[model samples]
Target: IQAFATLFQYGTFDRFPNLKFVVLESQAGWLGYLLDRMDAVFKGPMGATTDMKELPSTYFRRQCWISADPDERALANIIDYVGADRFFWASDYPHPDHTGDYIEALAELVAPLPSDTRHKILCGNVAGVYGLG
Candidate 1:
Protein backbone atom coordinates (compact mmCIF):
# COMPACT_ATOMS: atom_id res chain seq x y z
CA ILE A 1 0.00 0.00 0.00
CA GLN A 2 3.00 2.28 0.45
CA ALA A 3 3.48 2.07 -3.29
CA PHE A 4 0.03 3.57 -3.66
CA ALA A 5 0.90 6.26 -1.13
CA THR A 6 4.16 7.03 -2.93
CA LEU A 7 2.38 7.31 -6.26
CA PHE A 8 -0.26 9.61 -4.85
CA GLN A 9 2.25 11.72 -2.93
CA TYR A 10 4.44 12.06 -6.04
CA GLY A 11 1.62 13.57 -8.09
CA THR A 12 0.71 10.59 -10.28
CA PHE A 13 -2.99 11.35 -9.84
CA ASP A 14 -2.31 15.01 -10.54
CA ARG A 15 -0.38 14.11 -13.65
CA PHE A 16 -3.24 12.09 -15.12
CA PRO A 17 -6.43 13.01 -13.43
CA ASN A 18 -8.48 10.51 -15.40
CA LEU A 19 -6.36 7.51 -14.57
CA LYS A 20 -7.98 4.96 -12.25
CA PHE A 21 -5.89 2.96 -9.78
CA VAL A 22 -7.38 -0.30 -8.63
CA VAL A 23 -6.28 -2.37 -5.64
CA LEU A 24 -7.42 -5.95 -6.08
CA GLU A 25 -7.57 -8.90 -3.67
CA SER A 26 -6.99 -6.48 -0.80
CA GLN A 27 -10.07 -5.82 1.28
CA ALA A 28 -10.71 -2.14 1.95
CA GLY A 29 -11.10 -2.02 5.74
CA TRP A 30 -7.80 -0.19 6.24
CA LEU A 31 -8.18 2.33 3.43
CA GLY A 32 -9.88 4.89 5.61
CA TYR A 33 -6.99 4.94 8.06
CA LEU A 34 -4.42 4.93 5.30
CA LEU A 35 -6.01 7.82 3.50
CA ASP A 36 -6.38 9.77 6.71
CA ARG A 37 -2.76 9.08 7.58
CA MET A 38 -1.63 10.19 4.13
CA ASP A 39 -3.60 13.39 4.44
CA ALA A 40 -2.03 14.16 7.79
CA VAL A 41 1.51 13.36 6.71
CA PHE A 42 1.23 15.44 3.56
CA LYS A 43 -0.21 18.35 5.44
CA GLY A 44 2.43 18.16 8.13
CA PRO A 45 6.07 19.18 7.93
CA MET A 46 6.73 16.63 5.20
CA GLY A 47 4.39 18.55 2.91
CA ALA A 48 7.41 20.23 1.33
CA THR A 49 8.51 16.98 -0.28
CA THR A 50 5.30 16.62 -2.26
CA ASP A 51 3.91 18.85 -4.97
CA MET A 52 0.37 17.55 -5.03
CA LYS A 53 -2.29 19.91 -6.28
CA GLU A 54 -4.80 18.53 -3.79
CA LEU A 55 -4.86 16.66 -0.48
CA PRO A 56 -3.50 13.14 -0.93
CA SER A 57 -6.83 11.62 -0.02
CA THR A 58 -8.61 13.82 -2.54
CA TYR A 59 -6.60 12.28 -5.33
CA PHE A 60 -7.55 8.84 -4.08
CA ARG A 61 -11.22 9.70 -3.96
CA ARG A 62 -11.04 10.95 -7.51
CA GLN A 63 -9.03 8.15 -9.06
CA CYS A 64 -8.85 4.97 -7.01
CA TRP A 65 -10.95 1.80 -6.57
CA ILE A 66 -10.72 -1.19 -4.23
CA SER A 67 -12.04 -4.68 -4.55
CA ALA A 68 -13.76 -6.33 -1.62
CA ASP A 69 -14.25 -10.03 -1.35
CA PRO A 70 -17.77 -11.30 -0.73
CA ASP A 71 -17.02 -12.73 2.71
CA GLU A 72 -15.70 -9.49 4.21
CA ARG A 73 -18.55 -8.50 6.50
CA ALA A 74 -16.70 -5.38 7.55
CA LEU A 75 -17.19 -3.85 4.12
CA ALA A 76 -20.31 -2.08 5.29
CA ASN A 77 -18.25 0.24 7.44
CA ILE A 78 -15.72 0.65 4.68
CA ILE A 79 -18.51 1.61 2.31
CA ASP A 80 -19.62 4.28 4.72
CA TYR A 81 -16.08 5.63 4.96
CA VAL A 82 -14.96 5.39 1.35
CA GLY A 83 -18.29 5.87 -0.41
CA ALA A 84 -20.02 3.10 -2.35
CA ASP A 85 -18.70 4.42 -5.65
CA ARG A 86 -15.16 3.41 -4.79
CA PHE A 87 -15.76 -0.29 -4.29
CA PHE A 88 -16.10 -3.29 -6.57
CA TRP A 89 -17.32 -6.68 -5.53
CA ALA A 90 -14.87 -9.38 -6.50
CA SER A 91 -15.36 -13.11 -6.10
CA ASP A 92 -11.60 -13.73 -6.19
CA TYR A 93 -12.63 -16.89 -8.03
CA PRO A 94 -10.17 -19.69 -8.84
CA HIS A 95 -8.24 -18.85 -5.70
CA PRO A 96 -8.32 -21.28 -2.81
CA ASP A 97 -9.94 -18.70 -0.58
CA HIS A 98 -12.76 -17.88 -2.99
CA THR A 99 -16.23 -19.21 -2.53
CA GLY A 100 -17.33 -22.08 -4.72
CA ASP A 101 -20.60 -20.38 -5.45
CA TYR A 102 -19.85 -16.77 -6.27
CA ILE A 103 -23.46 -15.85 -6.87
CA GLU A 104 -24.50 -16.99 -3.43
CA ALA A 105 -21.63 -15.12 -1.82
CA LEU A 106 -22.48 -11.95 -3.70
CA ALA A 107 -26.11 -12.19 -2.75
CA GLU A 108 -25.22 -12.61 0.88
CA LEU A 109 -22.84 -9.67 1.05
CA VAL A 110 -25.13 -7.37 -0.86
CA ALA A 111 -28.28 -8.23 1.02
CA PRO A 112 -27.89 -5.58 3.69
CA LEU A 113 -26.92 -2.63 1.54
CA PRO A 114 -29.33 -0.13 0.07
CA SER A 115 -30.25 -0.56 -3.56
CA ASP A 116 -28.14 2.28 -4.94
CA THR A 117 -25.03 1.33 -2.99
CA ARG A 118 -25.51 -2.33 -3.80
CA HIS A 119 -25.76 -1.51 -7.48
CA LYS A 120 -22.64 0.61 -7.37
CA ILE A 121 -20.45 -1.95 -5.65
CA LEU A 122 -21.72 -4.87 -7.68
CA CYS A 123 -22.20 -3.37 -11.10
CA GLY A 124 -21.69 0.33 -11.80
CA ASN A 125 -18.31 0.67 -10.13
CA VAL A 126 -16.78 -2.20 -12.08
CA ALA A 127 -18.25 -0.90 -15.32
CA GLY A 128 -16.83 2.53 -14.73
CA VAL A 129 -13.47 1.11 -13.70
CA TYR A 130 -13.26 -0.91 -16.91
CA GLY A 131 -14.35 2.07 -19.03
CA LEU A 132 -17.68 0.42 -19.70
CA GLY A 133 -19.43 3.46 -18.35
Candidate 2:
Protein backbone atom coordinates (compact mmCIF):
# COMPACT_ATOMS: atom_id res chain seq x y z
CA ILE A 1 0.00 0.00 0.00
CA GLN A 2 2.81 2.39 0.86
CA ALA A 3 4.63 1.90 -2.41
CA PHE A 4 1.40 2.21 -4.34
CA ALA A 5 0.51 5.42 -2.53
CA THR A 6 3.99 6.90 -2.72
CA LEU A 7 4.35 6.40 -6.42
CA PHE A 8 1.18 8.36 -7.03
CA GLN A 9 2.07 10.95 -4.43
CA TYR A 10 5.40 11.50 -6.10
CA GLY A 11 3.86 11.84 -9.53
CA THR A 12 5.79 8.86 -10.81
CA PHE A 13 3.07 7.87 -13.22
CA ASP A 14 2.62 11.44 -14.37
CA ARG A 15 6.16 11.49 -15.67
CA PHE A 16 6.14 7.97 -17.07
CA PRO A 17 2.58 7.34 -18.08
CA ASN A 18 3.29 4.31 -20.17
CA LEU A 19 5.14 2.43 -17.45
CA LYS A 20 3.35 -0.66 -16.23
CA PHE A 21 3.21 -1.26 -12.51
CA VAL A 22 2.14 -4.76 -11.59
CA VAL A 23 1.44 -5.71 -8.01
CA LEU A 24 2.40 -9.38 -7.87
CA GLU A 25 1.88 -12.16 -5.32
CA SER A 26 -0.43 -9.81 -3.47
CA GLN A 27 -4.12 -10.00 -2.61
CA ALA A 28 -6.11 -7.36 -4.55
CA GLY A 29 -9.02 -6.72 -2.19
CA TRP A 30 -7.39 -3.56 -0.80
CA LEU A 31 -7.20 -1.68 -4.09
CA GLY A 32 -10.62 -0.07 -3.77
CA TYR A 33 -9.88 1.37 -0.36
CA LEU A 34 -6.47 2.60 -1.43
CA LEU A 35 -7.90 4.22 -4.52
CA ASP A 36 -10.55 6.00 -2.45
CA ARG A 37 -8.06 7.21 0.13
CA MET A 38 -5.58 8.36 -2.44
CA ASP A 39 -8.22 10.24 -4.37
CA ALA A 40 -9.46 11.85 -1.19
CA VAL A 41 -6.00 13.03 -0.33
CA PHE A 42 -5.52 14.30 -3.82
CA LYS A 43 -8.69 16.32 -3.66
CA GLY A 44 -8.19 17.59 -0.14
CA PRO A 45 -6.09 20.54 1.02
CA MET A 46 -3.00 18.39 0.77
CA GLY A 47 -3.75 18.02 -2.90
CA ALA A 48 -1.21 20.70 -3.70
CA THR A 49 1.51 18.67 -2.06
CA THR A 50 1.77 16.59 -5.21
CA ASP A 51 2.57 17.78 -8.71
CA MET A 52 0.28 15.30 -10.33
CA LYS A 53 -2.30 16.49 -12.84
CA GLU A 54 -4.70 13.60 -12.35
CA LEU A 55 -6.34 11.75 -9.50
CA PRO A 56 -4.32 8.89 -8.11
CA SER A 57 -6.97 6.40 -9.11
CA THR A 58 -6.93 7.77 -12.61
CA TYR A 59 -3.24 7.03 -12.92
CA PHE A 60 -3.84 3.62 -11.39
CA ARG A 61 -6.52 2.67 -13.88
CA ARG A 62 -4.36 3.87 -16.72
CA GLN A 63 -0.98 2.47 -15.71
CA CYS A 64 -1.32 -0.16 -13.02
CA TRP A 65 -2.49 -3.75 -12.61
CA ILE A 66 -2.96 -6.02 -9.63
CA SER A 67 -2.36 -9.74 -9.44
CA ALA A 68 -5.23 -11.32 -7.58
CA ASP A 69 -4.67 -14.39 -5.52
CA PRO A 70 -6.75 -17.27 -6.81
CA ASP A 71 -8.30 -17.87 -3.37
CA GLU A 72 -9.30 -14.28 -2.71
CA ARG A 73 -13.08 -14.53 -2.97
CA ALA A 74 -13.97 -10.98 -1.91
CA LEU A 75 -12.00 -9.62 -4.83
CA ALA A 76 -14.43 -11.13 -7.33
CA ASN A 77 -17.21 -8.94 -5.98
CA ILE A 78 -15.23 -5.76 -6.54
CA ILE A 79 -13.55 -6.55 -9.85
CA ASP A 80 -16.05 -4.66 -11.96
CA TYR A 81 -16.02 -1.60 -9.70
CA VAL A 82 -12.23 -1.57 -9.68
CA GLY A 83 -12.07 -2.09 -13.41
CA ALA A 84 -12.00 -5.71 -14.58
CA ASP A 85 -9.20 -4.80 -16.95
CA ARG A 86 -7.04 -3.79 -13.98
CA PHE A 87 -6.72 -7.30 -12.61
CA PHE A 88 -5.12 -10.65 -13.38
CA TRP A 89 -4.88 -13.99 -11.57
CA ALA A 90 -1.72 -15.18 -9.88
CA SER A 91 -1.42 -18.60 -8.24
CA ASP A 92 2.14 -18.21 -6.89
CA TYR A 93 2.69 -21.60 -8.47
CA PRO A 94 5.44 -23.82 -7.01
CA HIS A 95 5.83 -21.62 -3.95
CA PRO A 96 5.92 -23.77 -0.80
CA ASP A 97 3.61 -21.50 1.20
CA HIS A 98 1.09 -21.63 -1.66
CA THR A 99 0.67 -25.37 -1.65
CA GLY A 100 -2.33 -27.50 -2.61
CA ASP A 101 -4.50 -27.49 -5.71
CA TYR A 102 -6.08 -24.07 -6.23
CA ILE A 103 -7.37 -24.48 -9.78
CA GLU A 104 -10.81 -25.55 -8.61
CA ALA A 105 -10.86 -22.70 -6.13
CA LEU A 106 -9.89 -20.26 -8.84
CA ALA A 107 -12.56 -21.55 -11.20
CA GLU A 108 -15.30 -21.40 -8.59
CA LEU A 109 -14.28 -17.95 -7.42
CA VAL A 110 -14.34 -16.53 -10.92
CA ALA A 111 -17.47 -18.39 -12.03
CA PRO A 112 -19.74 -15.80 -10.45
CA LEU A 113 -18.22 -12.93 -12.43
CA PRO A 114 -19.49 -11.78 -15.84
CA SER A 115 -17.93 -13.52 -18.83
CA ASP A 116 -15.91 -10.55 -20.07
CA THR A 117 -14.68 -9.67 -16.58
CA ARG A 118 -13.76 -13.29 -15.96
CA HIS A 119 -11.91 -13.49 -19.25
CA LYS A 120 -9.96 -10.32 -18.47
CA ILE A 121 -8.96 -11.48 -15.01
CA LEU A 122 -8.00 -14.91 -16.22
CA CYS A 123 -6.19 -13.97 -19.42
CA GLY A 124 -6.73 -10.68 -21.24
CA ASN A 125 -5.53 -8.24 -18.58
CA VAL A 126 -2.15 -9.87 -18.24
CA ALA A 127 -1.56 -9.61 -21.93
CA GLY A 128 -2.67 -5.99 -21.96
CA VAL A 129 -0.39 -5.15 -19.06
CA TYR A 130 2.60 -6.72 -20.76
CA GLY A 131 1.74 -5.40 -24.22
CA LEU A 132 1.07 -8.80 -25.70
CA GLY A 133 -1.25 -9.26 -28.68
Q: Which candidate is the best by lDDT?
A: 1
List residue ranges in candidate 2 displaced over 4 A.
none
| Candidate 1 least-lDDT 10 residues | 51-60
Model 2's TM-score against the true structure:
0.93
Which ten contiguous residues of candidate 2 have the minimum total lDDT?
Answer: 73-82
lDDT of each: 0.87, 0.85
Q: Model 1 scores what on Cα lDDT?
A: 0.87
Score every model by TM-score.
0.92, 0.93
The number of the candidate with the highest TM-score is: 2
lDDT of 1 by residue, 16-128 (tens): 87788999987877898998888898888888789787887788788999999878888888888778999999888889977598999899899999999999998899998
RMSD of each candidate? 1.3, 1.3
What tens digits encode model 2's per-residue C-alpha lDDT throughout 4-103? 7889888899899779999987788888888988899889999998988999888988988898886787886667667888998988787787657778
lDDT of 1 at 49: 85
